[model samples]
Every structure is written in structure tokens, then in C-alpha cells.
Target: MESVSRDLDMPDDSNPLRRLSLEQLRRRTSMKWRTYPHDVLPLWVAEMDVPLAEPVAEAITDAVALGDTGYPAGTAYAEALAEFAHKWWGWGGLAVGRTAIVPDVMLGIVEMLKLVSSPGDPVIVNCPVYPPFYQFVGNLDRPVVEAPLGPDLRIEFAALENAFRSAGRGSARGAALGAARGANRPVYLLCSPHNPTGTVHTAAELTRIAHLAREYGVRVVVDEIHAPIVAAGASFVPFLSVPGAENGLSLMSASKAWNLAGLKAALAIAGPEAADDLARIPEEVSHGPSHVGVIAHTAALRDGGDWLDALLRGLDDNRRLLASLLAEHLPSIGYAPAQGTFLAWLDCRDLGLGSDPAEAFLKRGRVALSSGRAFGTGGEGFVRLNLAASPEVITEAVRRMASAVV
Candidate 1:
């Protein structure tokens, strides 16, 4: 990997693009005191410390200039999404007609939950998952069934099947009642290119999961926000694209990949039966999507490909650099560059961090990162690091970490 000094075309301090440096990001964002101090590097949050593409900026400016900030008409946004799906994922001219566009990823998940299940129902979640998955279920009074993970953080199929079968009659009853009452239950929240761990389930794995869901008569709500940012050699498999996954629902967004998270645009693609159910969700949700979000998302889909490509290259390089650094400085730590997502799950059990290195890195090294415990049971003794920043930022983070551990 090239050094930031050689590779990056440093922006002038006067330009917003130039202000994208770690120095400026610390000043502009409130992350300074909370995580990375003025001097320490930050590898914590999912947000990339990068500037918006010129096209994206232009679209937002153009929208505001025209005073067109009112709620967007659904047709154009839906078409833009359809085009992106076909162009990128080979989902072949799949039309997303009159879909309910929510404010953000979590909101979309909640909406899917609303469409499928009622309060106090059961939601199946894999352990060592993104923390929000647990909170989302708990907030709704939904009993969460813990699905243990394999050593690699991939789904333990046998355990998941057992959980689905014997998770309790309370769970089974809810599913059956939801099917009869026009509400769905026992929904499995599937994370594609899963967060924290960055494990991308293969098509075969997804097929097996779908078959199990089919046999158990449960619904699958897949969160695929990280699909667009996968490493170059990796291909993302959309759960709905797999055969026998006809009843599954897919959730995606430009937020994670394109750094449009604050703009709050996300999509929910449901199969035939699921789509019908989503369409019948209260009309109030029809307006949940912001006009600004739609505008930003449309612009990103229409003209953001070059920027996305560049980002993928930059992220891939950063991922490799960190992996290499870990291999050299912390030889005892074992990890591979994840096939998708900018987040890397560092196995720190060899370091003897005792289940929470995130705290040690912060208190001693002044480097802040998400604790593995935040992900769930199996996440202990590991740490999740975001490598979406400039190469210098990532390099500095590694340096700080090395100093503390050694």
C-alpha cells in the first residue's frame, strides 16, 4: 500500500474536499473527545472520513437551489433503485414499485418487523451480531432467540435449526398466530456481509438457511447494507436471489458504502408475499422516506459509480494494509481480510486481552474501537475496527495499538 503522502491528492485547506483530512474531520465532527483525541487515530465508527463525490454534492446543491425539498414522488426514486439493482447485482430488471422508503437502516428494520410480527413475538438473531440487532428486538418486547456462531462468526447451522425448532412453544405459537392473524412471527434477521465480523454468507449457505426457514415456516429479513463495499474478488449473494428464498425480504442502502448515512435513505425489497404485506403497511409509513434522502440516493445511483469504484479500491487497500500490519507487529493476533465490508474482526485471544481489548486500547493507548462484547456472547476477546479512513489514519491507529500492546 502506498503512503498517504504519495497516493492521496491532498485537498487544499480552503476546499471542503480538502477539509476531509483527519485533522479537519476532528474539528468538524464531534468525534474528537469521544473516541479519537485530537492526536490519536480513530478506527471506531462505520462512517468513512471521506468527502462526498462531486456528483453527490452537486445533486444536493441542485435540489436545494430549486427549493425542491418536499417529499419526493415515489416513481423516480423506485426506478433509480431498480436500475442500480439490475446494473450491479444482476437482479435483472427487478422493479421496486411503490415501495415504502424509510428514514434509515434501523427504521427499515423496524418497519419490516412491524409488517411481519407483533409486539412480544420472537425474533431470531445470530450471536456476535451487530449490537443493534439485539436492541431492535428488545425495544419491541420481542424475545430474541440466540443462534450461536461458528468459530469464524458464521452461522452455526445446526444450532440455528435447533433454536428454531426448540426455541420454545412461545416462539412457535407466535409464528403460527402471525401466519393466521395476518402478522408474521419468528422472523430471522439475516445480515449479509454481516457487521462487526464481515462474514459474507455464500449462496449455498443462504440456500440452506432459506430451506430451513421454509421448513419451519418462518420469514427471513435480510440486511444487506454492506453489499456495495465488498472486496473486489468477492461477490455478494442477495438472499432473495437464491432459489427457495421466495418469502424473504431484503434491506439495503447507500448509507454505508457511499457515506450518505446522515441523508438517511434505505430500501426494502420483499418477495411476492412479503412485498404485498409491506405495501399494506399503514399509509403513514409511505411518507417515512425523506425527500432529501431520495434525492441523494437517486443521485448516488445515477452518477456515483466512479466514486464508489474508487472507494472500493481505497478500502481494499486499507484492509490489506491493516492485515499486513497486524501480521507483522502483532504476530500472535490472527485474522484475514474479510471478503466484504470495511470492518475487520481482529482475534485478540492470543493477546490475552481477556474479552475486551477495546477498553484497554482506549484507556492506555488512547485508541477507541468497538468492543467485541458489544456484538454479543461469542464476540469476546476480539475487536472490530473500521478501515474506511485514509491510509494515514489507519496506519496511525495501528501504531497506537502496537505501542499499547507491546
Candidate 2:
């Protein structure tokens, strides 16, 4: 294990401050992976096994040392976050005002739903997506219209338009009546650089979507949690960056990239009309961010870019290793190229482990992964593998997977 100086400004892999043992690492991981048996290696959860940036660690320690673990007070974090977003992702210098903070990205989406939608109002969701997309919309009793994703696991805009038009009718008989009423009643819930399958929609793709949504005046809420993890060559276009997306709201987070999920801090950003709806989300949700989380998140946004770069590089390596392993040893499993994020989509249909390959892998191969069926109907015979662990761990996972299938 690498050591550090415990300095807020230092890198995670800098000169030695201490060393950690394999046993210690396993023990810590076991505490978090409580659902799995002791021998099972967990690659199911999205959290990274790597240590956080030095600044984030130092911030947490300092927060604890100073007894600053009280409830969140002012908007120090929001202001810092605004600068971070403007600098990091090149958002048109949008100021991260006090309204930026939310409990998490999921809550941000939920609040937006509450503010924009009435009961039974239709909301569009692409299939084989994050499971929470279903839960959040369902919990509100909102009627969800499924826009089945393309083979590439990207939103099919044409299909979305068709679904939106048909949703209000509810039945074949009602379809004619609803069409005559001509109400555009659905809002699209887009997962940018989508979870499970990591496909970053092109700028051209986004523009067309914006134009389509603008024509119907349907709201577009984009989950951009994986924006920061985009590799160097690929560009991550914010929905609001497109010409016709003046009303789009983008939900972003440091949690996905910085491993701050435990902190539960994320941002809800919007353009003019969208901002009006999103701004109505209560400050109480903003206050849900704990002091420790604020300290860690602020430190990560303000001073942890180098660490983030290293982490991205590591994920890239792991992605390549996993792909190579699948091709060489587990050829039956297919993986498409991932543009960003640490998750990989594995097509494990040929293994004959039934529809949910992840569960089978866990029980038989001692490798825990996310079941594909959990995403939606199209996700059958697939699984989502989180590649945020050490390279050795990923390689070992492949070995076990290969042996089990053979």
C-alpha cells in the first residue's frame, strides 16, 4: 500500500506516511460488503477500493479533530463547488450558488420530479438504466414511459418521441382521444454516460434531443454523475450546453468520481426555466450534507484534481485489462467499449447461467457483480461489473470467472 504525508495538498501516492497490509484492506472491505460471504470478492458496489485523495483524507481528519462534525451551516461548499464546476467541466461559468447542494443526485432528481410533475404525469426513462430511476419515479406514483435503449445502450430519441406521444392514451381505444387532446405530458429522465453501460452521447446526439424536447416543450432532466470520469479524448457535453436545452436540468456529483457516496453530497444545476423548477427544492435537502461530507467534498473539488486524474488512469487500465481478459480467457462474455465511468457491461448469455449472470457468478464463482435484470427487460443475460479495484483484483476476478465457466 502507498503512504502519504497526511497533508491536505499532497497526493494519495506521495512519499510514505504509513503502510497498510493486505489483511487490513480485506478487513475494511469486508465491513462494507456485509451481504457477501467472507470468501466472496465484491465488485458489485460502485464504490472504489482505492484510498481517497490526500486533501480529502486530511479534510475529514481536520473536521473530526476540530469537532466540526455538526450539522451543515452556511453555503461555503456551494460557492466552492460552483468554481469547481466552471473550472472542471467547462460549464459556462455557472456560479454554484447556495442552491447547488442537495442530499444526493437521486434526491435531486426526486425533488425535480415533485416540482415539475403532477401525480400520474408521464416521465420518460431509458431501459437497462440505473435501478433508482425506476424507484424514484415509482415512489412518486408517476406513470413511467419506457424508452427502450438502442443496442449500444443509448437513448433512442425517435422511440422516446413515439412513447411520449402514446403514453397519454393509456390504451389503444384511448390513444385516439388522447392524440386529439394534443397534450405533451412527459418529461425525459436521461442518464448521461449512463450507469451499467457507459456510453457518452455525442454532442450531435444531445442537440437533436434538445431540439426534439424543445419542439414538444417536454422537460429534460439529465443525470451527469459520471461527467468527470470521461477519458481525455472523449468530450462530455452537458445537456445545457446544447443550443435548444435552455430548459434542461443537469444532476451532477463528486461522489461518483471522488468516491463520496457515503457523504451523500451532489448538485442539481439548471438553466433559466429549469432553474426555476429546481430552485424550489428546499434548503433542508441542501442541509442534509454532513459537515464531514462538506469538508471532504470541498477538499476534493478544490484540491484533488491530480488524484482524480490518477484514479481515471487507473480505471482506464482496469477497463482495458477486463476487456483483454474477457477476450482471451472468457470469450463468451462480450463487452463494448466504455467511454467513461468505472462500470463495465458484460454480456454473459453464452455462459448458460440463466438470465441473471451476476448472481450465478457470486454463488458459484465467489465474484459479486450487479445483476443486469435489475436495470430492466433488455438487460437480461448481462451484468454490470465495477472495475474500481486494484488491477490485481480485477485480474483475479477474471481468472475465477474463466474457471467457473469452463
Q: Compared with the true structure, what per-residue lDDT tens digits does model 1 show for residues 222-268? A: 89999887888788888888888877777878888778877867877
User: How good is model 1 by TM-score?
Assistant: 0.91
Q: Which run of 10 residues does model 2 get worst, by summed lDDT? A: 1-10
- lDDT of model number 1: 0.77
Per-candidate local distance difference test: 0.77, 0.75
**What are the per-model numbers of colliding residue pairs?**
2, 0
lDDT of 2 by residue, 163-188 (tens): 76565444434544544565435678
What is the C-alpha RMSD, rounded to one decimal, of candidate 2?
5.2
- lDDT at position 256, candidate 2: 83
**What is the alpha-carbon lDDT of model 2 when measured against the actual structure?**
0.75
